[model samples]
Structure formats: structure tokens, C-alpha cells
Target chain A: MEPIIIEGTPKTPTIKFDSSKGEFEIKGRSIPENSVEFYKPLVDWLDLYKESPLNKTVVNIRLEYFNTSSSKCILDVFKKLEAIHKAKNDVEVNWYYEEDDEDMLEAGEDYESIIRVPFKMIEIVE
Target chain B: MSFNVESYFSDISSGNPIHFYKGNIDSDLINKVLDTVEGKLIKGNEHSKLRKKVYNVLVESLQNLYHHVDKVPDDFEDQTSDKFGILEVIKEENGYRIITGNFVQADNVEKLEEKIKRINRSSHEEITELYKFILNHQRISSKGGGGLGLVDIARKTGNRLEYQFKKYNEESSFFYLNIFVSENY
Candidate 1:
């Protein structure tokens, strides 16, 4: 599969999904007014990735701030990963937050509770 | 008391006003407002956590206005505008206050009020649970969010969502939302 790489913007996150390395990462702010439009391609790409199995997939999410709309889209992305996880593939999610950002930490926890994939909460020091 | 847009905007725009906008709201304006506010937050040397919190809530608040703001009343001064609204960012001693105002059809007032009241009544943990539940169950509408913007704002600020509905006319009313983000929080 051709890797999907989208550069970050002031309002959107950087997306890097390389199937060759089984590596996926989303970093930066995601406060787009139309989050569905911004995230639709990623969700589509994930659906395609699910077809060709990667033995192990590691996903990292490091968002500074995402609006509520983006939050829902993020969940959609995770739900797709959850499908792959349940299909007997190894999937791990690394959720990163700033040390003082308790809201972000709790956000990660919220996702951890909802999704079936294992999540590791990593704190970045200010 | 009846709500008057002119008085409300004048009252809130005073007292160390940072940014105040009264006009139509669209995607492009949202991006500009966020960029302008982010620049001011950085220039002020606000703490990272506080800055992020304020920015986050502002994003939700503005987007809420974008998604939900009603058309200006036909007789209203800004009749030419669509999705007309007012936004003010003020500098307070302990924190920043973000105030947004927009007209809503009188018919929709009760529903919107009940939603905010329900959110205000929820404890932090309960709100978190509610957010997760909605995230999982609710489908995203064409308007974009799954009714999660206000809930997310309350969850982030840990404060009651202050709001008022002023009677604009028999057909519609103006809604004002005040959100405060404290430096110490």
C-alpha cells in the first residue's frame, strides 16, 4: 500500500501512515471547522490498510489541541484500528500528552476506556 | 430583562478587551480568530496549560456559534449577514473570559437551554462518561459534531457554562455564552 502522508497545518495534524514499516502517527493541532472532511481520507486509508494485514501496527497520537468535531473523527479513526485489533492483528496506541495537560490525559483515558486496543499514555515534559 | 444586542456587546466589550468581533461567522473567520487569539496568548507569555485550555474552549465556543447560530432577524441591523454573531475576548485579573452571542429561533431556545443545564449539572466524572458515550453512539451530523462541543467545553474548564437568552422578538431571541479560563486552573 502506498503510504499516506499529510503535512500539519495550524488547524490540522500531521498524518503519517507507512504500511511498509507498519508505523502510523498523528501529531499537532486538529481544530478544523470541517473535521469530517479532514479525517475522511484517513478513515478510508485505514479501511484499505485493514485489507492487507500488517503483522504489527503501532499508532501514535500527539495532539496539542483538537476541537470537539475533531475528537469525534479521531474516534472514528480509532474504531477502525479496533476492528483490525479484533481481527487478530497486534495494534498498540501510544497516546501522548503534556505533563500539565490533565484534560488531554483524561482525553486519552476516555479513548482507552472506549476502544479495545491497548493504549500507552506518555507524558511530555514542558 | 429583555436582551438587547447593542447593550450586551458594549457591556462585554469593555474592561480590557482583547478581541471583539460582531459579524457573520464562517470557516475562514474561525481560522482567523483562532490564529489571532493564539498569537495574543503566546505574546502574553501565558502558561502552556492555561493557554491551551483557553484556546481549546475558544475553539469549541466559536465553532458552536458557527454550527448553531441562526440567521439575523429580518429587522435586525445586520440583516445582510448570515450566521451573524458577536464574540469578545476580555482580559480578567485571574483569567480570560470568552463571550459569544448569536440569535436563535425562539422555538429552539428551550432545547438548547436544557442541554446546557444538563451539562452544567453533571459532575466531572459524569461529564466524561457522557462524552465517551456520545462519542461512541452518536453519529456526526452534517453540521459536524455529535452535540459534543458544549460538553467538551464544560469538561475542559471544570466550570459551569454561563449563558443567557435575551428576547429579541416573538420569533427569535439572542443567546449569550460566557466561559472563563483561569490561569491557576
Candidate 2:
């Protein structure tokens, strides 16, 4: 599968998924006009990647902020990864939050508590 | 019997007093407002994290207006048409004040009131725990059109939610919410 790269904006995040290296990254803001439209392709890519089953899949999320719709899409992404992890694939999610952003750190914890996949919360110093 | 167009234009355009866009609020307009606010913040050399918080709150508030407000006209093309919401960022002595106002139906006021009260009553740590608890146990309820959005706003602001409601009619209310993130604070 070809890699997907999206530009980031004040209201949208950049999505870079490398199918070969199994490194998926979503960064910046995420308040897209239509969350479903912005995330559909990325979700589809994840679905396709699940079939090939990379030795290790690392999903990195460094979102400064996102809207409620984006939150739902993030949950969907995690649920998809959890499914892949359950199938005995190497899947891991590294959720990075700013050192002082306790809110984002808690959000990571929220996702961790719900999903069955391995989620590591890392604090990035700015 | 003549209209004073020049005077009206002069009064509206003078000094850039944080103009309010009142008619239909759409994604394009919202993006414009977000850009304006962000530009001002960056020009002022404000903290990057606080700017992010303000931007997030702006989007969530506008989305609430777009999806839930009932005053929107049927033919309004913009996502936030007739939504009757305001997003204003005023330069204060310290930093800036971000304000958003919209309308809420009467039936949904009680739930909103309860949620805000609960959030305002809790400490930051408690609110964090509550956010996780809700995320885990409570399925996103489609009631009021913005289930977790409000919670996310409260969480981002890091302060007790401040709100006021004015009786618009027998069945609806005007909701006003204000959040302040001081550059020094």
C-alpha cells in the first residue's frame, strides 16, 4: 500500500502512514470540516494494513487538540488497532502529550482504559 | 428620508473592535475567526499551549452552534446558518478573553446545567478522573447534538465552566459561555 501524507492546518491534523515501515503518525490539530471524510481513507488504509500484518505497527498520536467528532474517529482507530492486536499481531500505540498538558495526558489514559491494545503515554517537553 | 450610509460604515469599520459575525456561522467563517484569533495570539507572543486550547474551544463551540442550535434557517447553506452564535476574542490587560454564545432548547437545559455544575464543582484532578470515567462507561449520547464536546471544552479550559442562560421564549433559551485563559495565569 502506498503511504498517505496529509497537510496539517489550524483545524486539521496531518496523517502520515507508511505501509512499508509500519509507522503510522497523526499530528497537529484535528477539527476537520467533516471528521468522517478526513478519516475515512486513513481508516481504510488501516484495514488494508491489517491483512498484510506487519511485524510491528507503531501508531503515534501527537494531536494538540481535536473536536468531538475527531474524538470518535480516534476511538475508532484504536478499536481497529485493538482488533489487530487481538489477532496476534504486533501493535502498539504511543500517545504523546505535552509535559504540562495534563488534560491530554488524561485523554491518553482514557483511551488506555478502554482499549485492550498496548498504549504508552509519553510526555514530551517543549 | 435618506439613510446615512457613510456614518454607518465608519462606525462599523473603526478600530477593529473585535467585530461579531451574527448571521450564519459556517465552517469557512469559523476558520476565518480561528485564523484571526491565532494570528493575534502569535503576534502577541502568547504561550503556544494556551493558543491551542483557545483554538480547540472555538471549534467545539462553533460545532455545537452548527449542529444543535434551532434558530438556523432551513435554506442556510453554511453549516452554522441561523445558529445565532458569537465568537469574540477581546484583548485584555493581561492576555485575551474568548467568549462564545448560542441558543439551547428548553428541554436540554437541565442536562446541560447538571453537567456544567458537576464539572465546575470538581477539582482539576477530579475532573480528569471523571473525564476518563465517562469516556469508559458512558456511551456517547446523541442528546443535545454534542455529547463529549462540552466535556472536552471544560477539560481544555482547566477552569470551572462559566455560563449564563437567558429566556429566549417559552421553549428555548440563549446560552452564553465564557472561558478566560490569562497569558500570565
Top DockQ model: 1
Local distance difference test, each candidate: 0.89, 0.72
Fraction of the true interface contacts (Cα pairs closer than 8 Å across chains) found in each model: 0.78, 0.47
**How high is each candidate's TM-score?**
0.96, 0.80
TM-score of chain B of each: 0.94, 0.75
Candidate No. with top TM-score: 1
Per-residue CA lDDT of model 2 for B15-67, tens digit only, reads 23343555566778878887887787788786776666766777777777776
lDDT of 2 by residue, A1-126 (tens): 899999898778988999899898999988865676788778888888888868889999998887777777788788888888998989999999998776688778888988999998999986
Tell me the DockQ of each model, to 2 decimals. 0.81, 0.42
Using lDDT as the measure, the top candidate is 1
lDDT of 2 at B95: 48
Query: Ten consecutive residues with minimal summed lDDT in candidate 2 chain A?
Result: A32-41
Which regions of candidate 2 are displaced past 4 Å? A98-102, A121-126, B1-19, B72-81, B93-95, B133-146
